[model samples]
Target chain A: MKEISFKNDILPLGDKLYRLALRITCNKQEAEDVVQDTLIKLWEGREKLKEVDNLTVYAMTVCRNQALDHNAKHENKNISLEDSGVDGFDNQHMPDERLIYNQRYEIINELINRMPEKQRTVIQLRDIEGRNYQEISLMMNISLADVKVTLFRARQQLKEQLKKQKNGL
Target chain B: MDYKYIEQLLERYWQCETTLEEEQILHSFFKQHDVPEHLQQYADLFSYESEAAQECLSDDFKQRMLDMVDEEPAVEAKTIKFVSRITPLFKAAAVVAIALTIGNVAERTMQDNSVGDNAGAPSIADTYTRTEDITATIHIIDRNQSESMAKADTVQVDDITRR
Candidate 1:
């Protein structure tokens, strides 16, 4: 069996993991943390990774899970604040009116960020990451059909947003 | 140059029917500044995809990760190996210490006896005192009498004559 070098084999997956995490978490710091945690996990379990068929996909899956967990915790924190009747707790996803008047790309970014986690991740993996449906399915642990469906919904959402942006413009 | 192909690809793209290559064609078509005004709205989405893929971790992140992985277990392994490697030597030292303690105790006891007795000097005096007691009890048996006693063994002729 060929030896797996962390620097060669695993570290290169950091950016992919970061993109997935950032797509899921919508925060750079949280995404970086998720990637760091995922890499450390892969390094710690490198001994058992020999049996893994696709280490890259496995790392992405782990990063995705960690990112989702962070998002869940963050939402829960926000929910708790809401429950406590905290006033002026601004919503992070709500874009200001000026951002709508800014570059079209920011609006697209905002729209992508507002989608469901599965849809956002599916778009990130399929379109941005250039991953096939099979690989996306494997990374997300979803069926192939589900990956396409999620991606279709995501793309359709973007189309609707583009239409709305055009009308607004 | 008809915009029909891109328009069709964009339609298929929205329907999730475009192949990856077809999608790349659309992305490339949109990247150019000559994008027809009618198809311009979709360009940002494709361009975003292209640019977002370029997003990467900072330069120091990889170094930080390497540092984290490299530092921890090495220190732990060094400490563990050092202890494991020297444990037997420690046990051997403990055994030698116990043996030396027991030897010191035994030697001290022996020395105490030797010092108190002055190396058998008191035993010689004790023997002399015992001999004197016996001489007084037997009233100074001469050498001839001792020889006669030895020859006669248990028969005491002197005692019989006195009787």
Candidate 2:
């Protein structure tokens, strides 16, 4: 309900926003840019946002739309989202354990990445980000029921996939 | 130790009936030292969930954003307020000032050349003298031609006579 300060409010959301955008766009750089653009856009539209509660969720919604729009426009690019620094995990300590950890995590990420866009985003927000169903529904602009349905499908798919590859681990 | 409660929560989790806190308890149980041998398969999912949440924008991202934000406002303000609103006024004033200066200087110079023959620029006297003034000066020079043939003078003779 107050003017959103970029430093106190929007800048701090960069990680959460980036994670959401990364979930939606599946590309780290694109996700990062989406967060940047979302911040700037919120600043530009601060006057309109004065009456809006929960600027972080508002910004997340805006960021998601931007990411979807970006994905749509560059649909032809077809660059593998994994190429956006899939090796971002730190590997200096516990080289052997870290290697194994990275491999399993990479597989996990790959499985998650292969999910449908909506399902993947729902999983990232609800499971990874620990956001509640109501907040995710609001951010995704979908009904609470739809959020549950999407998450259900995503969890089922992830369980089956992880089980199928259990021997390889 | 018994693990029936977590297993039930996991079942409820798959059914999408678990509350956020219950789901979190499931994640916490799986994240521990031992995830129970029978239920180990779900470890990666919840572990990955926790790990992936740690993914974040790069360190410099905040600095870059602040730089961009700070830089944009100063530039926009300058363009809108100074260049658009005030700069043109200064430019027009400058042009008007230069025009007035040139006009005033030229007017005074012309006045001096016309009103004061000897005081004005001597070059303008030859080019812009009236016909009567030229003729009168020529008569004076004719009367003094013999004495002035040497090209010496107490008075300022017209430069043309020496040439």
Each model's Cα RMSD: 18.0, 14.8
Q: Which DockQ values do the candidates obtain, in the order shown?
A: 0.54, 0.54
For candidate 2 chain B, the 10 contiguous residues with the lowest summed lDDT are B149-158
Per-residue alpha-carbon lDDT of candidate 2 for residues B1-163, written as tens digits (9 for 90 to 100):
7998988998898888898898889888878967787788889888888888888888799999987788655645665676578778999999999999999999999887676766554675577368988888888888799677655653446665666
Model 1 local distance difference test score: 0.81
How high is the lDDT of residue A35 in model 1? 92
Clashes of 1: 0
For each candidate, give the interface RMSD after superposing the true interface residues on Cα. Answer: 0.9, 0.9
Q: Against the correct fold, how does model 2 do in TM-score?
A: 0.70
Q: List the residue pairs that clash in candidate 1.
A: none
TM-score of each candidate? 0.66, 0.70
Model 2: residues >4 Å from true position, as ranges? A79-85, A89-94, A167-169, B72-163
- For each predicted model, how many residue pairs clash, with residues at least 3 apart or on different chains? 0, 0
